[model samples]
Target: MIDTSMGLKDMSKRDILVNVAVLIGFIILCMGGGGIMGAITRNDFGDRSEWYKALIKPSFNPPNFLFGIVWPILYLLMAIAAFAVWTKTGLTKEPIPLVIFFIQLALNFIWTLIFGKAKDLLASLVEIIILWLFILLTIKKFWKVNRGAALCLAPYLAWVTLAVALNYKYWELNPNMKPDYSWFVLKTEL
Candidate 1:
């Protein structure tokens, strides 16, 4: 009986290590995916002040530099939220929520490509709406396992909501706006 108890304790320790490793792996994957996408769609404009000069922004728009500060922190929070879900329940059982999280991540990257690279304001707006929906679904699912996980994503959802509205305003104001290939050069001049 003592031997059997020892075996069970060993098994429990192994399980705990495995779960911790898995959570770390998930967090790394989430951050790595976002990093790769950011690299691929990186803006070439050096001065970033060019972003400010673009047509006319909504009066409520945050300063351009704030975007740089906001996104990295938000991405980190999202990865932690995902890790929370993974640690609570392995990926296989709660497939639906995991899938929704991935869908939103894909949508999130697509918006970056559309707005930052392709400069398609309307397309980015549509993508953000889809991203918002997926985030809501993922939050609902994660809440079942870890309410903290779900709560962590709330700020991301709120930011996307603001982004969607901003995108809509830009599209409305600059109906004929196209991707400015000269942005890099103009930024250098500034």
Candidate 2:
């Protein structure tokens, strides 16, 4: 937006550009955290065919490749929504909305670890439920700050709802799948 006579209150071109940059930066930060965590916990080659593929998935269950595409978009939307709230109440002052946002963000990563790394279907179901609630809370708080921001999270909430179904279906189908926590246990014969 080119502003010839720059009003004191009106945003100039530089302001607009700067805002875009900041928003993009916010998106990159969120995506980076999620991507890093996913990389850490993800199976080799990003294809868990040997593991997840072997399991019996429901008909509604999406192809694994779809997840690879969907998550980045969701993360971007989530970051934009959070940034909108952050603009209203920055880190300087303790903001309840931001607090909820961070909590949900942490839960997001935790869910990935539980499902992907731990391979605990039942536990993942429980954790995803908690994450969904936190996302709702964050959306409610964000709505008070910016309606568009809250709306941005709607897709995320919807996706998670679908994920809940998927998680439940997997849990129901595979009654014998348990997390292998033996890695943490020591094998001392003594």
Candidate 3:
């Protein structure tokens, strides 16, 4: 008997292959979208700021190189997680998970802008906390339709946890360093 639970109750091997190919194509599209966003974030923000370099980071803080490595991997995992959920529910059946996923991803970009571009540790802390909650919501939404998709987000959650701590510590350690980023300051920074 075909596995209806998988939503793959179909006819021929050729059909299955084509369906899998389509799914793969979708996953690739998601990855590409994610990559483009990441590249834009990287190019726009482009490395640790002078303010960031001057901060008194906690000993627990990972190196700049580590973030460079982790973020791309996390982005890939996010794409895979979304792909898994899409395979289960499709665009019509339930779209909330995908919407939440995209929201969290956008929040991810915002956090980078606050932390990396503005160098506003306090604002970044707040934004990252919001991002963290969105990630939890996305994972919960994914869990309802696909457990593996939820599991894929675990690393992203963990990394954000580290970021929360780092943001808090930097804010705490260098009260002198918090840049007042008004619209004027933002324009100057840009």
Candidate 4:
């Protein structure tokens, strides 16, 4: 976009190129954030963990690969939605929507840790319910800023809703299971 009052029609080629690059950068940044966290949380590689394999899961549980596939797509959509909101209000103005977005994203990572890493069924379920609510709050806030941005989060909300149910099922199946936290506390040699 043109820096001045001129319309897009007046944007110079360099300005257009820079804008495109910046947009791409935003997408990469957002998706990369999720990719890093997802890697930290997932446990489906190399014959899978015996602990996870033994845990009773719901009949409707999805294949592990499905998670690897679905999350990236969802992250991409979230990135696009965030970019849309940023385009509307920049970073400083209309900060609530973006703040909610980050909060939800953080909660997302926390749920994975509680469920996947820590193996705390009850905690994961509770955390996910909060995450789902925050997702809804984000959608409502994004709607006030950009309808398109809000719509982009719909699938995410749906996925998290499914997750909430799945986590509940896990909790029911593993009521007495204690969370493993030996890995959670970092061990280091001084």
Candidates in order, TM-scores: namely 0.78, 0.82, 0.77, 0.87
lDDT of 3: 0.76
- Order the candidate numbers by TM-score, best to worst: 4, 2, 1, 3
lDDT of each: 0.73, 0.81, 0.76, 0.81
Q: Write the per-residue lDDT of candidate 4 for residues 111-188, one digit (tens) a residue.
A: 777777888888888899999999999999999988988999999999999889888998898788889877689899
lDDT for each residue of candidate 1 in 52-170, tens digit (9 for 90 to 100): 25646789888766876877778888887887776556567666767788888888877776777667777778888888889899899889878998999999989988888888898
Winner on TM-score between 2 and 4 is 4
Runs in model 1 deviating more than 4 A are 1-13, 44-46, 49-52, 179-190
Q: Candidate 2: where is the Cα deviation over 4 Å?
A: 1-25, 44-46, 182-190
Among all windows of 10 consecutive residues in model 4, the one with the lowest summed lDDT is 41-50
Model 3 / residue 155 / CA error / Å: 0.7
lDDT string, candidate 2, 1-190, tens digits = 1232455468766766766776787787779888987787677223653668667889998877888898899999988887777666665654898788889989998888788777889988999999999999999989997799999999999999999999999899999887865533679986
Clashing pairs in 2: none
Give per-residue CA lDDT, model 3, range 39-93, as digits (tens): 6556434253555567888999886778768877887788778877876777677
